[model samples]
Target: MSLTEIRSRIAKACDAAGRDPGEVTLIAVSKMQPDHRVRAVLEEGQRVFGENRVQEAAGKWPGFREDFGAVELHIIGPLQTNKARQAMELAQAIHSLDRPKLATTLARLADEIGTCPDLFIQVNTGEEPQKAGILPSEVDSFVAEVRGLGLPLKGLMCIPPVDETPSLHFALLAKFADRNGLAGLSMGMSGDFEEAIALGATHVRVGSAIFGTRP
Candidate 1:
C-alpha cells in the first residue's frame, strides 16, 4: 500500500528469485494520479514512473521535472502514430511498441532527431483480438522488422488476459526476448510482479499499490 512496502516486497521477490533488487526497475504508474499524490511519491525518492498518455505526461511531467530534477518516464499505453514524436520526447522508454506503423514513425523521428527512446514490443500472448499487441505467432517477424528499421528495441512487454494465469504469459514473453537476444522484459503489475521477477522481468509497472486507488 506504500512505496516502501512495495519496495520491500520487490526485494523479497528478488531474494526469492535469486535476483538483485536493482535488476528490476519499479515503475510507479502515475497515470491519472493527482499531482499531490505524484509529488508525494517523488518526495519519497521514486523517480521512475509510467504514464499511459503522451498529452497527459506532457502536461504533468515538465513541471514535475522542474521540481524533482530527474524523472524516468515510461509510456506504457497504446501509442498512436501521430503521438510518437511527443512520446519519444517525454519518455525514456516505451512499453507499447506494438505495431509496424508506429515503429516506422519512430524510426523516421529517430533519424530526424538523432535519438530514440528504448522500446518494448507488446506481444498479445493471450491472443486477445481487442488488445493492442503483436500476435504471439507474429512476434518473431515483428522483432526482425523493428530491428531492421534500426529502432532501439530493448525487449518485449505483455498484459495477460485478466482471467488467465499471468506467469504463463510472462514466461512466454521471456522466451521471445531471449531468442532475439533482447534483455528487457516489461511484464508484471501490482499483483504478480514477484512471479514475473522469478521468470525474469526487468521492469514491473505498479499503480494503485504505490499511489493508492484513483478516483
Candidate 2:
C-alpha cells in the first residue's frame, strides 16, 4: 500500500476500535531498507520507526538522523549483551527487553548514560523456543526484576508463532500487559495489524506495507 493509504487504514482501525488516532502509534519497521528510503519516509512525516539488527541500524541510522532530527528509532530485534550500551545510546526505545540479564545490562548502561528510553518486555506468547523473549509464565517475575533495575517499563511486545491466528497472541499480550500494569502493546505487523488494533494493540510495526519489499 502507498504511505497515504497506510495512514488512512491506520486511522480507520483506530476509529473502529474507539481509540484516538493519536493514541495508537505507527512504527515503520525499516530493517534491510536503505537509508534513502528511510529518509523519504521520514520526509513524508513518519516520525517513528523500528530497526531489527543493531549492526544494521548503527550502520544506516546516521544518515537518516542527520536529515530528521526528531524521529524516534526503536531497536526491535534480539539485543546482545555486548550491544546493550550501543542500543541504549542509539535507540529512542528498545522493544526486545526479554530477559533479566539484558535488562540488567540496559539498566546499567542507562544509568551511566543518564537516559533510559522506553522499555518493552518481550513475551514469547507463542512459546517459540527459538525466539528471543520471556515465556508467558515468566513475564511477571521478569517485570519485577526489571523494575528493580530502575528502568522505565512502558509496555509489552511479541511476535506470535507464524502458523497461528495473530489475534489470539495479541490478546494474550494485552492481557499480560494489563495484569502487570504496563500500558503499551507493541503487537502486530504488515499482515495482521487491524486485528491487532481491535485487540488493544497500541503500537503496530509495519514494514513492507509502507516501505515496500526490502532489499
Candidate 3:
C-alpha cells in the first residue's frame, strides 16, 4: 500500500473510533529494509520509524539522520540487556521491554547517561511459551518494579498468537495499560491495526503494507 492509502486507512480507523487521526502515531517498521527503501519513505515525509535490531539500526540510521535531520526511531523488537545503552542512544522509544534484568540495566544506564527513551512493557498476552514478554498476570508487579526503577514507562505492547483473534489481545493490552495508568498502547500492525485503533492503540507499527515485502 502507498503512504497515502495507509494514512487514509488510519484516518478512517480513527474516525470509526471517534478519534482524531492525529492522536495515533504511525511507526513505519523499517527493520530488514534496505537503505534505499528507507530513504524513499523519508523523502515521502515519514519521520517516525521502527527497527527490530539495535545493530542494524545503528549501522543505517546515523547516516539517515544526518541527511533527514528530524526522524524518530523506535526500537520495536526484543531488546537484549547488554544493548540497553546503545538502544537508548539510538531510539526515541522502545516497545519491547519484557524483562527485569533489561529494566535494571536500563535504569543504571539512565542514571549514568542521563537519558532514558520512552518504554513500553511487552506482554505475552497469548501466554505463548516461546514469545518474549511478561505474562498478563505479571503486569502489575512488573510495571511497579519498572516504575520504581525510574525508567520512563510509557505503555504496553503485544503480539497476539497468529492463530487467535487479535482483538482479544488488543483489548487485554489496553486493559493492562489502563490499569497501570499508562497512556500509550503500542499494539497493532499492518494486518489488524484498524481494529487496534478502535480499541485505543496510541501507536501502530506497520511494515510491508507501506514498504512492500522485505527483500
Candidate 4:
C-alpha cells in the first residue's frame, strides 16, 4: 500500500476508536529492512521508526541519521544488559524496559553518558514465558520501582498472545495504563493495530505492511 493509504488506515482506525489520528504515533518498524527503504518512508513524512535489533539498526543508521534529523527511533524488541549503553545512544525511545538489572544499567548508562532514551515498561500481556516484558500483576510495583529511578516511564507496551484476539489484551493494557496515568500505549503491529487504537494505543509499530514483506 502507498504511504497515503497507510496514513489513511491509521486515521480511520483512530476515528473508529473515537480518537484523533493526530494522537496516535506510527513507528515504522524497520528490522531486517534496508536504509534506502527507510529513507523513502522518511521522505514520505514518517518521522518515527522502530527496530528490533540494535545491531541491525546501527548498521543502517549512520548514513540516514543526519538526513532524518527530526525522526525518532525506538527499540521495540528484547534488549540485552550488555548492549544497554549502545541502545541508549541509538534510540530515542526504548520500548522494552523489561528487567530491573537492564533498567538499572540503562539508568546508569544514561547518567554517565548524559542522554537517556524515553523509557516504556513492557508488559507481557499474554503472560507468555517466552516474552520479555514484566507480567501484568507486577506492573504497578514495577512502574513504581522504575519511576523512583527517574526514568521517563512514558507508558506501557505489550505483545498479545499469538492465538487470542488482540483487543482483549489491548483493552487490559489500556485500562492498566489509564489506572497508572501513563500517556503512551506502545501496542499493536501490522495485524491488529486497529484493535489497539480502539483501546487507546498511542504508538503502533507497523513493519511488513508498510515496508513490504521482509527478506
Candidate with maximal lDDT: 1
The residue-by-residue lDDT of candidate 4 on 20-46, one tens digit each, is: 999999999999987677788889888
lDDT of 3 by residue, 1-215 (tens): 88889999999999989999988999999999988888999999999999999999999999999998978999999899888889999999999999999999999999999989999999999999999999989999999999999899999999999999999999999999899899999999999999999999999999999999999
TM-score of each: 0.99, 0.97, 0.99, 0.96
**RMSD of each predicted structure:** 0.6, 1.0, 0.6, 1.2
Rank by lDDT, highest first: 1, 3, 2, 4
How accurate locally, in lDDT, is each candidate? 0.95, 0.89, 0.95, 0.88
Candidate 1 stretches greater than 4 Å from native: none
Give me the overall lDDT of model 3.
0.95
Pairs of colliding residues, candidate 1: none
lDDT tens digits, residue span 1-215, model 2: 87788889988999999988887889999999877787788889998889998899888787777867767889999999999888888888999998888888887888789999899999999898799899999998998999888999999999989999899999899999999999999998999999998888889999999989988
**In model 3, where do residues sit more than 4 Å from their true spots?**
none
Worst 10 residues of 1 by lDDT: 206-215
Global Cα lDDT for candidate 4: 0.88
Model 4 stretches with alpha carbons more than 4 Å out: none
- Give the Cα error of residue 55 in candidate 4, in Å: 0.9
RMSD of 3: 0.6
Model 1 has a clash total of 0
**Residue 9 alpha-carbon offset, candidate 1, angstroms:** 0.5
